[model samples]
Target chain A: MGGLTVNTKLLRQILVGFVRDEVYKVGVRKGVLGLSGGIDSALVAYIAAEALGPENVHAYCMPYRTSNPESEAHARLVAESLGIKFKVIEITPMIDAYFTLTPDADNMRRGNKMARERMTILYDHSAAVGGLVLGTSNKTELLLGYGTLHGDMASALNPIGDIYKSQVWALSEAMGVPSEVIEKKPSADLWAGQTDEQELGFTYREADELLYRMVDQRMSREELVAAGFDAAFIDNVARKVQGSHFKRRLPIIAKVSNRTIDRDFRYARDWGK
Target chain B: MDFTVALAQIKPKLGCLDDNMALAEAAIEKGIAAGADLVVFPELALTGYFLKDLVPEVALRLDSPQMEKLKKLSERISIAIGFVEVSADYRFFNSAVYLEAGEIRHVHRKVYLPTYGLFDEQRYMARGERFRAFDTRFGRIGMLICEDMWHLSAPYILAMDGAMTLICLSSSPGRGVTESEGLGSAAAWQKLTTTTAMFLNCRVFYCNRVGYEDGINFWGGSEAISPSGEMTDRGAILEEDFVLAKVDGGALRRERIFSPMMRDENLAITVKELKRIDREKDC
Candidate 1:
């Protein structure tokens, strides 16, 4: 991880092209995304606005009642800087109504519900605006399955899915994302005081190194331990990755024919185009 | 002796052999007009890089029609270009061919096929058995395709075989940026070519392509380094360019006389060391 670096300028150029080509190839010129005032979403919005002009890219700041005010302000700042269409969609009623029905629902269930509701609103807006939904989950989160399924994980196209969370910060700074958002502690804004690191039991930097060794280098558990990593930490990270394997791929469709969907019938995203 | 070389930094469309051949033909005409003795193109210029599944379909044989056209073009000016070589046994190789006066002068299959990071060359192409230099009209010339040049042994083998000019064809992507070096890939290449030329005391020419294919952008910072590690010419980044540089055999001789690095190098000892390692280890 010492020499791990990225050419932010080149990455920006490639991602801009990725967002543009990936969306326009599917017969759409407009893109819609949730701007959470976090590094990942901010980077996506910046790229989307650059790819599909600021006019074509739509940003929605769907904040819950308990969400930090600074988050909304920062999201608005991003929208203004990019000069894109912005909306403040209050998700209070939606989450509160669900809580009213299931008053004993835990924080994890409520958080998942909020994530799904935000994505639902995004899709509804995508339909109204005739744009595709752009995803903001980075590689680190996707690998650890930190995202809620069919929620924040849902996207018609993801330009930054392959870039790790650490790389996301690099690109964000290079792309001129607000410094305040860049330096803040990352959180899902799921509950009142839930920081992502505190919840995950490891820092993004630590997790990225472990994941890079395990996934990219294909290092064994013994190799990781020998490389000066904690054995228990390695075990925990490996178990999390193994358990979350299903979150990264398409739903398993039991094969009944020679060419079942999501198998042999699968084609590239830009197949026809 | 002096040899005039042309570095043709071009963007080749993936999986389109006929179009790429046409492009090469046009570049050959330009090189001839520029009075270049040898024109070098990027690795896999005839088929483009990152041919994951399209390698077999676009691969050509030694007697391919495209090779014939290139041979005909070489009657005017010598040409060195990269292509996928198909063997009789159905194995494909990432290879390069040097043509002069309508005949194949030398064929070099890339010895080191990079399999790490963004590269997956070993999956599609067979590895070359050895590295060697062959005779040319200007002087003895050596050819390496992309990753082959990265390994010191490849160039050393060629230099030992009396190669005066080393031509490396590459399709390197622009990646990693440090404040001091600018584009990390280009900077690393500058050091690699210059150091290899200085240590081996032979002129080195590196030609890389520019353009996007499936999200990866190949930065075209093609360059020519003199025997003394002096850069003769460098191409623009992310653009198509045809640059000319003179490789001076006299300068190489002077450098060799002054430094005599090749004379000091002990190939016999290095060979023994490698053999010992190989016998002791599975690798």
Candidate 2:
């Protein structure tokens, strides 16, 4: 189902170079990131270690008590494999402490709360190490809006944000990530049985091919259906893309003044002046 | 006369005019030290590409001190460069310039402002209007800034105007890593330049920038193509590289005499057909 193949060798070079240059440009040669042990985080950990030397890469594995133990093991595996700086901070106490006040929290709320807690820890660790927070969200989750805003989505830079999840496996393999980590079922590990596919209602392979055609190729809905995509699947995917539009952009600022912050007063994140 | 030209595949500091100028000065000095006749820089070489709202901030008037400083360097060896140009009317243009003997030889404002897909050039800057070749100490040559050369008419117009050398200054971004070959955008550019060189019977020296800006990356595969469509030299892809290639007048003359495509060009018929197409567009 995943026909989108990239030149792994060249892609690795470009991504590694991107991380190296971007991290150094922002006045730091170091990068800090939350390593979830999923393919996305494992892949980013590998790239960050390669870009800034392993010594400069600080990886945090913040897992809730409910998170599968394998998640922590694989996270440790990736960190040890890369020889990057590693830490494991159990997120249960902070998350449970907050939820103890608000006992009516559902699965979605707990998951989001844990994600944001990990984000705060990463930022705090970033300041501790004087490094930028590296983002781990891939294109699939980003486009689907499956990530928690200001939580897992927050980062100073993301080398893999543009890469699709379907492609992340291949990139992870190419970069020598442990096979077990790459081959595992895609999961957020928020709960005992939680997997991304169970929640998203579709595999990444299906979504990637569909999104490649629907977005990159700019195929119309009629054309997509005619090309053999199920109407319901197409509808579901398109809605998520549309629904998550705000997640991909800066917050909207009302134009009370002539030049708004992001509206008309736009400057690049790498602005030299 | 045969002469050496240095393709300075530079990486510009985004919106930092002084830092970029230092880069330009260093490259120019290296070119002179190498005994090259000319040094070519990429589009907006003094100010990095993707300067969305920072256009006016980095733009320089033709008579600005920065322009004068670069002009004075041309006394040793001719220079071809790209920058944001501000007109007396206060409109900014993506412009390429040729400098020789401490004087500005010619300035070509980029004609086609690409506003599609990943590019949004038309949003912030004014588009250039025409393609006109000009004379330098070397010979008659034309300048194309990135997309200007994408349209067939841009290079064709210059060749028909008696220019035998076409210099393209580019800040092309790297994309499409899935192509069977190398980068998809790079392959497209290579095909474009190789065919243009063969058809126009001219020397095509392309200098493209390297470096990353925000999330975008510029691929730097600067090249020199001979009239016979032979790739004489090419800079490293996706990295900073300074490569030198020779411009042999004898080679150009021989290729033109052998191919004779430029010799047999029927501009009158082309003009008539263009006029007819223009008239039909109004229908």
Candidate 3:
């Protein structure tokens, strides 16, 4: 039902301006991103380079010992092509030190730990280089709560958060990202032989259309089914989108006063005057 | 004379008067550079909408220094903008002003203070009673603030009072989505503006702001409609635009002669009917 496509040239200009303005408003022109060599990170890196010049953009390839080598190479390729600084930081030692204590740690725990650790590394690099952390999470992953909270989702600012995964692929191709990075199977690389589609049970194209109709179009489950979507599929996507709602917002503060921080004192992102 | 209006759909920071005025002045300069005869801003463009308790703090008197700066800008071109008006009685009104040649030409206080839904305007601001049109160098123009135009009678009264150009400043949030129409609010507003133009035989300028403020987002689909029920030009949706469009007085005259809706309207009969209904309602 959703056949939406973005004009890459126009989108590039808009996003580049968004990045520049949002960054400049905060009195900073430098940006740092945790590059996983996936389409999302690759796209963000390219845009950041375009917005803040290649000299001001920095990319870090934080991989675990068991992480795929292809991912690290792809991340390097992105940095090299954009003429931005690239660094490789292995999270194997840091992750294993904690996991060694908990012998029964599951794959989820390990993945979450890795995600948070990578964020820690990115933030540290951001401070060292005087750059803000650029978010790479797309709208589909953000809505579905696919990324770990406060881990992969943590950022000073996000340029592609409103874009869907399917749209991200299209934008990536249009932005001239490497063909290998665009064609590769999407993955979090939490463990060996792990892939995103296998874990989610549906391809991004299918889920993206479902999300576009449900969220953007505001179609109900019944309406979606009547429009020819599988009832169960629609229900599943709805549940995921609903369940992940908390990840999209700030932590709720108990409001005992008239001007509670996030409650009554909520202001625009650039309220510092 | 054919007048060109610069419909500036901009987002102003809430409770930040200095910044908002600076932005307004910049837009005015840009519009002047674009050869516009008049420039229009969104409702409460100076103080921002949803002020709540901050209304009185940010409210400006007609002689306030901020308004003096705005008046100085109007020395170059006609300026139409919205702000909270602090009266001599110390009451505030959600108001729009038409400033020209370093003077306050006209002001229209918002008659309808929408209290229900997301708006709490009635809680903080007093309602205005009069709807008047005033003469400018370009033409006789009327100003309505946001919800005032939502009520049909506001524009109708202005049209009857000899306003040939209707300027509406709105801070309306985007809501509702149907398959046929992308944004329901935008579609509804388009119909309202175009119908008002066709029925009143006047040019309509609808200026809406864009940006997120306190959770509610103002969708900017500002447009200029001709007297012939045609959308002459429109601004970008959810983006800032400083665009100018020509309004032909000749076309307006031709449309008035062709349709003659205003000429055919029997105001005395309608007033008599309304008065009789009021009297007979006791039965």
Candidate No. with top TM-score: 2
Provide the global lDDT of candidate 3 against the true structure. 0.86
Report the C-alpha lDDT of model 1 over A91-197, residue by residue, as the tens digit: 99989987998899998898899999999999999999999999999989999999999999999888888788888989999888989989999989866677999
- Candidate 2 off by > 4 Å: A1-3
Arrange candidates by DockQ, highest first: which order?
2, 1, 3
TM-score of 2: 0.98
Q: How well does candidate 3 score on lDDT at residue B105? A: 99
Writing each residue's lDDT as its tens digit, candidate 3 over A11-50 gives: 5655676676567656777999999989999999989999
- The alpha-carbon deviation from the true structure for residue A184 of candidate 1, after best TM-score superposition, in angstroms, is 4.1
Clash counts per candidate, in order, are 0, 0, 0
User: Clashing pairs in model 1?
Assistant: none
Q: What lDDT does model 2 reach? A: 0.92
State which candidate, 1 or 2, has the greater TM-score.
2
The positional error of residue B240 in candidate 2, measured at the CA in angstroms, is 0.9
- Model 3 chain A weakest lDDT span, ten residues long: A264-273
TM-score versus the correct structure, for each prediction: 0.78, 0.98, 0.82
lDDT of 2 by residue, A1-273 (tens): 434788888888889989999988888889999988888989999999888999999999998888898998999999998999999999888998899998999999998899999999999999988999999999999999999999999999999988888789888889999999988899988889888999999999999999999888899999999999999999999999999999999888777998889788878888882
Could you tell me the lDDT of residue A245 within candidate 2?
92
